[model samples]
Target: MQKKALIAMSGGVDSSVAAYLMAQKGYDCAGATLKLYDNPQCSQPGERACCTPSDTEVARNVAARLGMLYYVFPMQEEFRKNVIDKFASTYLNGGTPNPCIDCNRFLKFDALVKKAQELGIDYVVSGHYARVQKDPDTGRYLLKKGLDSTKDQSYVLYSMTQEQLAHILFPLGEYTKAEIRQIAQEQGFINADKPDSQDICFIPDGDYASFIEEYTGNSSAPGEFLDTDGRVLGKHKGHIHYTIGQRRGLGISAPQSLYVCGKSLQTNQVILGKKEDLMSSSCLVNDINLIPWDHLDGPVQCKVKTRYRQPEQPATIEQIEKDLLKVTFHEPQRAVTPGQAAVFYDGDTVLGGGTIVTEAQLK
Candidate 1:
C-alpha cells in the first residue's frame, strides 16, 4: 500500500507544483488549503486578498488536475489567535513580528499535521524552501537550508521541533525557483504566473498601522517622538507606525538623520536616535528551540542571523536559561530587532533558534 500524504496547497505556483510532485511520486496525495480569514473589509480597498475565494478555486482546480482529493480547512479562529493577535501584540509592544513564521508554526505544522494524523496520512508536505534529513548515526531529523541558497527559508523554520521535522516534507527544497516555475508552467497551472504576495497577506498594501487599528478597533492615538535623552523631537502618528531602524517619514527634519531607536508603551512615545545607536553586539532570545543537540552546555560558535534576509554572522550561542539563549556576535549587528527571530546555523544545518527579546548595546 502506498503511503498517504497531505499536501498543503496555497493556491500559489509553488504549492500547486508541490501537489503535482507529490502525486507523481506515487503517494496517495490529498490537497488541503487553509482558509485563514474571510474577506476583511479594509477601509482602504475592496480587492480580494491573496488567499481569497478565487485562490481557493484555483487550488481546487489544481487538485483536480492532479487527480487528488481536495479539502478546505477553515482555520480562521486558530489563525486569528496564533498569527493576527500575535502580530498586533508584537507591534503594540514595539517589536517587529514575522507572522509567516507564526503561521507555519501553528497552522501548517501544528494544526495541519494534527489534521493529517487524524486522516491517517503518513506525512504532511508543503512547498517551503528548506530540507529535512535524518542523521544516520543518531537517527534524528535535521533541518537544513534549501539548495537554492538565495531562496532558503530555514530561518523561519528553526522553531520546528525534532518531531515536527520528522513528519514534514519540503518537496521544493532541492529545486531552484526557476525549476519550480518551469514545473508549474509544464503542468499548465493557473497560478504559474501569479505574482508573489509581497505584503502581509492580510495587510495587502503594507499599511500595518491602519490594519491593526481596524482589526483590533483600537486607535493608537498620535504621540510624541522623543530623542534618546527624553527630549521631545516631534509628534509621531503612533508607536505602531514605526519599527526599529526605520529612518524615513519621521516628519521631523533635522541636520542629522535619525532612526527609530525604541518605543515607550508607558509614555506612548517613539524614541528616535542616531544611526550608530542601532548596532548591538549581544542579544537575549526567549522561547528557544534547540536542534541537533538538546541544549548547549557552553558557548558554541555558529553563524547567526538576526533577520531573515541578513547574511549569517559569526556568533557564540549560549543557553542562558531553559527557554533563553544569549548570542554574542563577533561583529556588531545592526538593528537586531526584538520580536524577530534569531536563528542559529552551523553550515547548512539549522542549529536552533529563538525569539529575540532584547539586544545589548556595546559597552
Candidate 2:
C-alpha cells in the first residue's frame, strides 16, 4: 500500500508547497484546511485572518491542481474553547499567553491527529519551520529547529509529544522562507505570492483587548499603576493593555524611564519599575511536556527561551514535581512573564517545555 499524508494546508505559500512536495514524493496526499473561525458571520473584511473563506478556497484550488482529495474541518467551537478562551483567561489572570502554541498543542496535533487516524492517514503534514527526527541511540523521536533561523518556529512547538512528532511531517523545515516561496511559484500555486497571515485569525484588528472584551462581554476597567515601593505612580488604562517589558504608551512621567514589570489581577493594578526590576533569576514552569525522555532526573544544563523571538539563554532545568520544572538562567533574564512558555533546548533539539507559572522561590 502507498504511504499516506494529510497535508494541513493553511492556503498559504508554505503549506501549499508542503502539499506539493509530499505528493511529489509519491505519498498519497490529501489537503485539510481547518476552518478555525465561524463562517461569514465571523469573517472580517480585509484583515489577515487565517481561516477565512478565501483561504479555504485557495486551499481547495491547490488540492484540485494536485489531483488530491481535500477536506474542510470546522473547528470554531474547539478553537474558541481550547485556544481563544484560554488566551483571554490567561491575560485576565495577569499572565501573557501564546495561543499559537496552544493551537498547535490542542488543534493541529491533538484534534487533527484524531481526524487523520479516522481517515487512515499515516502522517499529518504542515508547513511549520521545524524538523522531527528519531534518535538512533535511544530510539525516540526528537523535535529539532528548522534550518532557517530567521523563520525557526520550534519555539511554539515545544508541547509536541513523541507520538505526535512521529506522525507529523514538516517538509518546509529544510527550506528558508525565500526558498518556500520560490517552490510555490515554481509549482504555480495560487497563493504563491500571497502575503503571510500576520494577525491572529480570531483577532483581525490585532487589538487583543477589544476582542477579549467583546468575546467575554467583560470590560477591562481602569486601574492604578504602582511603583516598586507600592507608591501610586499613576492611573493605567487597564491591566490587559500593559505587559512585561512594555515602556511606551505609559502616560506617567517619572524621574527615570520605567517599564511594566508585573500585574495584579486581585488588586487590579499594573506595576511599573526600572528595567532592572524586569530581570528574573529563575521561574517555576508547570504543565510540562518532555519530548526526548519521560522526566528530568537531575538538573540538566541546557538553553532556555521564555518567549518566541527571544534568544535562548543558558539555563539549568530541574524537575521539582511530576508536572513542575524550575528554569534558572545563568544570567538573570528580563521580563520572564508567567503564562508564556519556557522552552528548553539542547542545542537544536527541543528538550521539552512548560508554561512559566511564577518566579521560582528566591533563595
Candidate 3:
C-alpha cells in the first residue's frame, strides 16, 4: 500500500509547489488549509491574510488540480489560545513574543499532526524551508537549515520533538524561493505570482500596539521613559509601544540617539539609553528543546541567533538546569530581547533553541 501524507497548503507558491512535489513522489496526498482567523478587526483590506476565503479557494483549486482530497481545518480557537493570546500576554509582561514559533509549536506540529494521525496518515508535509534527516547511527531525527540560506526557517521550527520531526516532511527544503516560484508558474498554480505575506497574519498593518489594545479591550497606560541612570527623560505613550533596540518615535530630544534598552512592568517605565547599553554578553533561556543531545553536560560552543532575521553569533551554551540554558556570547550581542527564540546552530544543523528570558551584563 502507498503511504498516505497530509500536505499543508497555504495557497502560496511555496506550499502549492510542496503539494505538487509530494504528489509526484507517489505518496497518497491530501491537502489541508488551516482556517486560523477571520475577524475584520484583526486584518486590513487588501492585505494578504493567511487562511482567508480567497486563500482557501486557491488551495482547494490546487488540490483539485493535483487530483487529491482537500479539507479546511477550523483552528481559530486554537490559534487564539496558543498564538494570539500568548502574543498579547508576552507584551503585557514587557516581552516581545514571536507568534510564528508558537503557531508552529502548537498548531502545525501538534494539532495538525494529531489530526493527520486520526485520518491514518503516515506523515504531514509543509513548505517550511528546513530539512529533516534521520541519523543512521543514532536513529535520531536531525533538523538542518534549508539549502536556500536566504529563506531558511529552521529557527522557528526548533521546538519540534523527535516524533514530530520523524513524521513531518518539508518538500521545499532543497529548493530556493525562486525555484519554488518557477515550479509553481510552470504548473499553472493560481498563487504562482502571489506576493508573500510579510506582515503578521492577524496584525496585517503591523501596528501591534493598537491590535493588542483592541484585542484585550484595555488600553496600555502611559509610562515614564527613563534613562540608564534612572533619570526621567520623557513620557512614553505606553510600554507596549516600544521594544528593545527601538530608536524612533521616542518623543525625546537627546543629543545622541536613544534606544529602548529595557522595560520595567513593576515601575511602569521604559528605559532608554545609548546603543551600547542594549548590548549583553550573556542571556538565560527557558523552555529549551535540545535536538543534538539530551543535555549539555558542559559548555558547548555554537552560533546562536537571538532573533529570526539576525545572523547567528558565536556563543557558549551551558545547561544550568534541566530546562534552562545559559548562552554566553563570545562578543556582546545587542538587543537580546526576552520572549524571542534563541536558536543555536552548528553550521547548517540546528542544535536546539529556547525562549530568551533575561540578559546579563558582561563581567
All-Cα superposition RMSD per candidate: 2.6, 2.0, 2.2
Candidate 1 lDDT over residue span 152-242, tens digit each: 9899898898879988999999999999999999989988988765557778777889989988999988999998899988899988999
Q: What is the C-alpha lDDT of each candidate?
A: 0.88, 0.90, 0.91
Cα deviation at 181, candidate 2, in Å, is 1.0
Q: Which regions of candidate 3 are displaced past 4 Å?
A: 43-48, 359-363
lDDT of 3 by residue, 223-305 (tens): 89999999999899989999989999989998999999999887899999998999999999999999977889899999999
TM-score result, candidate 2:
0.96
Show the colliding residue pairs in model 3: none
Error of 3 at 5 (Å): 0.8
The full ranking of all candidates by lDDT, starting with the best, is 3, 2, 1
- Candidate 2 residue-wise lDDT, 274-298, digit = tens: 9999999999999999999999899
Q: Give the TM-scores of the predictions, in the order they appear.
A: 0.95, 0.96, 0.97
Error of 3 at 207 (Å): 1.3
Decide which is better by TM-score, 1 or 2: 2
Worst 10 residues of 3 by lDDT: 42-51
Residue pairs in candidate 2 whose N, alpha carbon or C atoms collide under 3 angstroms: none
